[model samples]
Target: MTPALLKVQGLRVAFGDKEVVHGIDFDIAPGEKLALVGESGSGKTVTALSLLRLVQNADISGTARFEHDKAGAAARDLLSLPERTLRGIRGKEIAMIFQEPMTALNALYAVGDQIAEVLELHQGLSAQAAHEAAVQLLADTGIPEPARRARAFPHQLSGGQRQRAMIAMALACKPRLLLADEPTTALDVTVRGQILDLLADLQRQHGMAVLLITHDLNLVRRFADRVAVMENGHLVEHGPVATVFGAPRHPYTRRLIDSRPTRDVAPVPVDPAALPVVAASGLRVIYPVPRPGIKGWFTKGEFVAVQGADFRIAPGQTLGVVGESGSGKSTLALAALGLLKHQGQLDVAGRQWAAGGASDRGLRRLMQVVFQDPFSSLSPRMTVEQIVGEGLTVHAPELDVRARRARSLAALADVGLTEDQFPALLERYPHEFSGGQRQRLAIARALIVEPKLLVLDEPTSALDVTIQKQVLGLLQRLQRERGLSYLLITHDVEVIRAMAHQVIVMKDGAILESGPVGRVLDAPVHPYTQKLVAAAAT
Candidate 1:
């Protein structure tokens, strides 16, 4: 039998006074694909980081033996490797693709420069050679116009492009092992499939073992050869992917699989009385793309983000837009809120607003938005009070500071946050709050506006399953009490089934189908929509 490429035993990690990961054992064979599945804070990422000695300010103890190519060789304990020696192994023998590409990449440096830096550090390549190789790597990762895009910074690329660039950088040196932590979390479904396919292709061509850490069970079931389940820092189960998925021994794993939204199950019907208070028609948004350099002075190209998409919402209704990444779901939401420059017909609170612009205070008064990442959206320097009250300051300036404070506290209560927690939460910054709390804070801020319509762009994507359920329930309750409408944009079909009354299926900036959530999801008319629903189901 072939020796394992990577063997980890009795692995444990602890921060000061707190143990995040208990002793766990696992192995990866040559060219094998292994998945670490768990909820947030489940030690999946910590375990992966521990393999590279990247766990900071923590006490890590374990045996991690890496057996290289030669049969007769000295086994290296990766946990005990010195920094310099570990650096040598980092990008050349082992590469890691982080969860958040935007933050993982440097904003100031060109994408090419970042990729080149990896080659220079590991392979000692010349700058010219590195740049040329970087372009090729980007192309290999399925990025378009690799030459031009290589020179662009992280901010210039879309979420999918940024993720691809990160993959290119990780694979530039052809590492023997790759650690991918939720690499497809931010990508649209189509782009996500492409990236996953690329990873599988590279694994085959290079015979590299992969450790994929993700909450997405669908991806794991499709791509992984072996599976390891973790819960609250413990390794609950590990086995062949088919064995574990088909006959899940762990209750947590079974719950996760069942929690995933499915077309097989019928959606519960929401009463018509609980419909959206606002609606839109023929929504369109076109962004101008400038040509290269001086050529842009006279030439321009238009990028249509949302094209003639129509939907409606009665009071307390949640309308979900489901599509792959870059399918213009968010663009449609922005257009609905009049936040993007678009040609569309929108009615909020029975008033015409899409004809006017987002800048119109009247339109702003009728709608609000809660973004995906609360850490970035909320002001890090400001207190929770400041963050929540900012909307009131803008839309209802006539309200006194005392009145705003009372309203903010009430909003917090509406979302299940207590006033007594205010002393600690109100004065504290965003980083102090947990992921769920931060998301609740975002919802509170949106609710403070008391708008008829709220645009939620992947609000629960970053959260764990339990937190997601809680947040979903909170939104439903708040809708019932406040009579608010929701325009939820997400790739999560399960969320749509749980909360949406109407569903809009979009692709390539156009609506493929739109109808009642139950009918469309149960009997999808469009092939693309059916694929999306199927992908989510398994």
Candidate 2:
């Protein structure tokens, strides 16, 4: 049998006096796929970064031996390699695709140039030759209009296109091993599947191994041959994917396997005469796009983000909008929040928004929104008190400072945060808290206004599985306590099933199906809905 392509023995990663990745061991064979599964802060990313010595000032001690077939290139210790030698091997033989492609890529340069840079650096290709190769690579990754896209800057491409560009760069050199760190975590479900399939196809063609670092179990089931479960700093379980998932030996492994979101509660009937928290009829949202130089002066083109739509969210009920990226879910949320202009009728609490009037101000207090990615959504410079109380200032400017503080504290308490646990709760800034805590702070910020309807746009998409569960539970409790309404916008079918009573499946800014969660999820009639469910379940 062929020997392992890469072997890690007693790997440890440390920063100053703290050790985060304890001694761990694993191996990857040629043309193999191994998934490193764990929650946030579980040492998964650090472990992968340590291998390539990419962690800044991180003290990594381990024997990461890479096996090569060339002369004098038999097993060599990558951990002990000098800086220059490691740089030579980084993109040429061992490549890495970071989690966020947007930030990973250079904003100043076009994506094609980025790929050409790698080719020129490793293969010593000429300027023209590299340009040709780069365009080819883009085409290989399934990006349309390769030459045109290659000329486009990183920001010009969509999320999926940018990710595809990143993949094209990573595989430009035909590396022996690829380390993908949550490659699809930020992408939509359909795009995630496409990226995974692309990786699998590329791996087979290049005959390279993959070390995938992610918390997504479905990706592991579909892609990996072996799985390694990490908890805190330890490798709790390591074995074949089927074995580990079918009969996990470690308690942590079992918990991880069983962590998929489950239905929490059934919908209780509401009064027939009661009005919906939010209502939309024939909702159409259109944006003006730039036309070509000649046509620009005559007429601007229009991009319809949301087609004519109709839906109603009963008070105390969750209306879930599930779809891929660019689907009208977010657009619908924006329309419902009165942030964007729409053609059709949309009312909040039986009232239509009157732009910048007393009615609009009152509606703002009635309906608030919680955006995705708490870390970025929350202002870094603002203290907890200021962040939560800022809404109060806009809604109830007449209130005194002390009254606002009391209300803010009460709102924080409702979301399970208190001054008792965090003495500097009011004074502490966003950077001081963890991801989950930051989300809680966001929730408190939203609740401080006493909103009747909350437009939650992918609330738990950025959180870990366990943290997501906790946040969902907190939201559920808040709904029960306040009889609040929620417009949950997300791509995760599991989250929709768990939290939503009514579900709407959307594609290309159009609703494919809408009904009770169980009916749509369990027995989806539309092909798109069925595809989504199948992709999620596997």
Best-performing candidate as measured by TM-score? 2
**Candidate 2 ranges with C-alpha deviation above 4 Å:** 270-272
lDDT of 2 by residue, 259-306 (tens): 778666647596768798888899999999989899898999999999
Separately for all candidates shown, the number of backbone clashes (residues 3 or more apart, or on different chains) is 10, 0
Q: Measured by TM-score, how close is model 2 to the native structure? A: 0.97
Candidate 1 structure lDDT: 0.86
- Residues 480-511 of candidate 1: C-alpha lDDT, one tens digit per residue: 77767788999988889888888889899999
Q: Would you give me the overall lDDT of model 2?
A: 0.92
Best by lDDT: 2
